[model samples]
Target chain A: MFYFILDILGTIAFAISGVMVAMDKKLDVFGVFIVAFVTAVGGGTLRDVLIGQTPLFWLKDLTYIVTIIGAVIVAVVFRSRMSYFKRSLLLFDTLGIGLYTLVGVEKGLAVGLSPIMCVALGTITACFGGVTRDILCNEIPVIFRREIYATACILGGFGFFILRQLPLEETYSYATAILIIIVIRLLAVKFKLALPNIYKST
Target chain B: MFYFILDILGTIAFAISGVMVAMDKKLDVFGVFIVAFVTAVGGGTLRDVLIGQTPLFWLKDLTYIVTIIGAVIVAVVFRSRMSYFKRSLLLFDTLGIGLYTLVGVEKGLAVGLSPIMCVALGTITACFGGVTRDILCNEIPVIFRREIYATACILGGFGFFILRQLPLEETYSYATAILIIIVIRLLAVKFKLALPNIYKST
Candidate 1:
């Protein structure tokens, strides 16, 4: 039940990011919807495919599509009002990353991947959609260039795995993972932290 | 032998397109190579995943990566001279589309998809990388707005299926499909053809 709620929340948060980019580009309605849908579901779809899950999640369930459309409508209607809540969007995006990272790691572990691969999957699931969205928007993925994006997810994934080994409650473990990720990410952003660029020549 | 030759040709042509785009964006060596590799194989990767092919093509055959790197290096070194061959890029792009469409249709049929689905897959395989490239470049996908882009692939797929039912040789059938696609696309471009924009408000 917690996973389900967080999944939907993450999807909504992702959709908002996509919609903002689309609006920034002055994309038409169809374009907006396309961007939003892809942003919301792209990571999960790639993860599922790599894990040999067929038909994909959105294809099987319409709720995701509905939620994306709902987000789009809200964005469209509240375009001006939503501008005032830019910080709130950041909060949701950060929270979504944490929630998605946990779910993705759990899914990877459920499929019997090694802990390393599970962490990789978790990070990919949290970041790849935004990567695709940024690529589609003709921008460098902020996650790729920014500090503590993938790193935060990896840390949180490890945190979840470690907590699972303890005698703690599931909710507590989940919340701990989310909190760890969110705190790290917020601090990174606030401090203007960045990973050193690998290719210094360019 | 034909499939292998066509595949290599398509890879080279697609690699050139990627290099050109990267150059236009003033990307460094790594960025150029990344774009070139994705452009060369992105469509096929998407198709393979959709069809449940494991490990992905590049993972199975590292040569594809080597080939794209070679193409990118050549383009970078000859960037000024290659700009003189703008018409050649058009020709190669068309040829790549023709070859990719045929390969995609064959793969779809091999996997037991319906004829319509096969044609859809063919069109997707031929144009999706370019679509991705354009989107990443902050432009609309030519396939979505161009009247004859994906249409040519669909027609070619249909031609292949139809010709196979006749007494034509395999080479003849394949050549016929390629010719049909190339001719249709070139004529459409020459005539400035485009799909009707469905954006009522925009």
Candidate 2:
């Protein structure tokens, strides 16, 4: 139940972020809704599909969709004041990603995938929503070019496996993994760290 | 066996198209291969994932991967003379899309999805590979802004359903649908038809 609530919060944060970006791009109403919907659920949808989960996460439970729609509406209504809540949004997003990575790792383990593929799946679950949003908006995915966004998910995934090998309880290890992701992302942003760029400035 | 062969031919054509595009973008060899792999298998992957099919089409069968790698190598070897086979490539891509659409529709029908959703699955299977490729390369999807690419698939999808109502053999309807997509695409290209522009010029 606690995890479900957190997942809803994360979905709300993702949808709001999508709304903000779509509005910035001046998309039509349908476009804005589509963007928000995808941002909120795209990662989970991909994960579910990859694992052969039927009806999909969103399709199986309408709560995620409802939350996204509500979030989009609220964000759009409070667009001018959104800046004041930027920190809250960012924190939610970070928490959301952390939880998402854990969820993905768990699902991969359930499906008997290799550890490496599980990590990859975890990373995909936490980050690919934004990737799809960027693609739809006709921009390069920000994660591919900069920051520790995906790296945080990957590290969190590896940490989960490592923690599992320890004598600690499963719940404790899962909590630790989420914490690892949240802290890494927060610290990375605070320190302005980024992945190394391959292309030199022309 | 014939359908499987057609699928491979489609995969090879898609991979070659991806290789050409990645090469044009000056991506590294790894990047080129990734593009080729995704282009050849991405659509089917999405479809399979959505329907809760396990192992994925590529993962279940090595033939698809081997064919894509082979196609990439052949295209690269003949890179300079690729212009000579442009028409042939286009035909193969058209045929591939047609086959892909059919495959998607069949999968959806097998799973008992609604007709509209089945058509959606078909279109997604036929086109999203190119969409993924363009996004990775940092360009707007050409199908979204122009061309009858998706339209052809959609029309073909509806055609398939409509034809099912007729008192004819199943094979006849399937063949007609594929031919419809191919013919529509060819005619649309030859006449330079496109979806109307959405944005107003400043």
Candidate 3:
């Protein structure tokens, strides 16, 4: 039940971020909606596809559609106050990724994927939405260049696996995984931790 | 049988194009291979996912991986002479999209999607590889801003449906549809026919 709520919150958070980027790019309303929808679901969709899951999670459930629409409306109405809301938005976004990483890892394990593949899926789920959003908006994906986003997810996935081997309850292990992701992300942003540039510009 | 050969050729063309882009961006070897692989199979993978097909077309086949690797190696070895091969590459690419459009439309129809959705799938399959390629390379999708690329695929899709309704042989109708797409694309490039800008610059 908590996971379900966290999934919805993450979808809204991702959709809002997508809206912000689309608006910044001056996309048409249709384009904006498309971008937002892709941002909210792209990661999970990719993971589902990779695992041979059919119809996709969003297509099977209309709630995601409704939530994205609500997010779009909210973003449009509060466009003027977007800058001021950045910190709060970031908080939601962080929590969203935290929850999503655990969800993705669990799904991978359920499907009997290898441990490494499970971690990769978790990272992909947490980061690919923003990557798709930036691509549609015609920018380099911020996660590829910015502070430790996907890395935190990777670490959290590892943590989830490690904690699961302990004698603790599944819920506690999951919560610990989520917490590890959230704390890592918060620290990364707070301290400006980032991966080194892969390509050195001449 | 013919479709299989055309699909492989298309994969090679797209992979070569991806290698060119990655090299231009100065990405490392791993990045180059990744970009190439995505460019070759990204479109069909997306089409398959959307239509509830899974395991992805490329994953089930090893030929695609080998073809992309060969293309990448050739691209790197012949980097300095790429400009001279542009005409040949363009020819192969045109054929690739023509064949891919029909393949996508056929797949969609086979899955019992609506006619309009089938056409959309055709356009996506023919063009989205380049879109993914550009996105991974951190550029605006050339399709979104450029010439009549996707338009050709849409027109070809309609042509397929129209021809299917006639008394023509199945092979003839399919051939006609592919020919229409190739001719339209060739003419568009030759005459520089392009869609009007969505956003008029001040």
Candidate 1 accuracy as lDDT: 0.81
In candidate 2 chain B, what residue range of length 10 has the lowest lDDT sum? Answer: B25-34
- In candidate 2, what are the lDDT values of residues A1-202, reduced to their tens digit? 9898889889989998899889999998889999999988899877877777877867878798788888988998899999999999999999999999888888888877767667767887888798789878887566756667888998999999999999999999999999999999999999998765422122
Expressed as tens digits, the lDDT of each residue in A1-202 for candidate 1 is 8668777878988998898877776555555666787788888878888898864566546688789889988877787677687888878889889988877888898999998899889888898898878777667887778567889999998988899899999889889998999999999889988788888577
Is candidate 1 or 2 superior in lDDT?
Answer: 2
Candidate ranking (lDDT, best to worst): 2, 3, 1
**DockQ of each model against the real complex?**
0.11, 0.16, 0.16
Runs of candidate 1 with Cα error greater than 4 angstroms are A26-31, A189-202, B1-45, B51-127, B133-202
Classify candidate 3 by CAPRI docking class. incorrect
Model 1 lDDT per residue over B130-166, tens place: 7777766667554544356777887899998899999
Locate the minimum summed-lDDT window of 10 residues in model 1 chain B.
B193-202
Give me candidate 2's TM-score against the actual structure.
0.62
Deviating ranges (above 4 Å) for candidate 3: A1-53, A56-131, A139-202, B200-202
Score each candidate by Cα lDDT.
Answer: 0.81, 0.85, 0.84
